[model samples]
Target: MRRHVAEFPDARVVLNMRSGSWALKLPFLQEVVGHSLRSIYLVRDPRAWIYLMLYNSKPSLYSLKNIPQHLSLIFKDDAVREGCPSVAPEFKTIQSVLSRSEANPALVLAHLWLAHTAAVLRVNEGLPEESYLQVRFEDVVNFPQETAETIHTFLGVPLSPAALNQLLFTTSTNLYNLMYEGDISPTNINMWRQNMPRKDIRLIEDVCGGVMKRLGYTRLAS
Candidate 1:
């Protein structure tokens, strides 16, 4: 922090932690960064999270003790260094359910997702709603303009129409555009319905029902 202050004295540092809810784990972060610090918390559809975990488990899993190292690798320019973050991935509870012998990976991932999300929700209860903003990935991709305006407004940043258009164009571009392209597509919003098996989807809905409800996500009819 001291070095950051020395180097970019006039700049405000925006720290992003997508894997774990650092606010819940490190209460002091709020104090150290000061009360003026505003947060943007991104929540993905639980099914999407499950699909990601099925393919990439280890990196997506979080551990409080290794977060600093994880963040260092995450911020590295090298493609090989990037990885998803998780909190307490090695805890006995997670290990028991995600063991190698576990035949149902989706179910395991769903449980893990639920556990982590529940922790975040519980910890956030004490925080003032104005201190942070929660945005759904679905909304950001489908309604880029509105989402951008909301985010900028929440952070008290002035964004002109030109800037917003550039942002949208940049984000809506296809991923193949090497220079910079946005993979913002509505197709991914419910891609899980086609990809995940019915039983697995049911498992996620059953286990994560409460959190899903709080986040305003409708579940499959039972």
Candidate 2:
């Protein structure tokens, strides 16, 4: 969007970014962006964020092209698809990991999304008041029109009626599960309790728990 906006002489920045982008704090972002830009800092429950990441990790659900070229090993697993024509020969690596991991893919995703973004939050603890006003995805999903109204008002931009309608109708579907009809009941929320490798989950917790709890993760009772 920034690049698209840049083409016009009167173009202004309309940043649709995460609350934890930490751009304002980093000199690189601010130095490059300067006063010529404005942004909409969208945020969501770290849990939901992580869960979506895990769900998107499945080869069936995502395009490998979306994966950062630099994070090749990370997404190169069988989970990453070569493309629509067909998967490449080397796709088995991700396939095996998907098959071998004991963790429920959805739960693993929730935990990672939560842990990673919570860590990002902790990393940028004291940003200036005007830098970003965080908005939760949960709240927006529940009251989308109100959120849109708030955003339009804040940025002084007109969010078209069509845009508002699109927001209201977007359906939530689980990417990993077979295509079917059902609510994304959080019944699987803690499936990690049984299936995830103890060491990895422990590493996740130790690395992100302090901030995770601050953002409302339920810690296992000691």
lDDT at 83, model 1: 69
Candidate 2 residue lDDT tens string, 1-222? 446545664765444556533433333344445444444445544433433343324542323333323223444443544552233333323344344446444433443354345534653455444444556555565667888888776666799999887766652332223232123323343344555456545555654566567654555543
lDDT against the true structure, each candidate: 0.64, 0.47
TM-score of each: 0.69, 0.45
The Cα error of candidate 2 at residue 155, in Å, is 2.0
lDDT of 1 by residue, 138-187 (tens): 78777889999899999888879898887677556644222121244566
Candidate 1, superposed: residue stretches over 4 Å from native: 1-11, 14-23, 55-92, 170-182
Question: How does candidate 1 score on lDDT?
Answer: 0.64
Model 1 has how many clashing residue pairs? 6
Clashing pairs in 2: 44-137, 50-109, 50-113, 51-110, 77-94, 78-94, 78-95
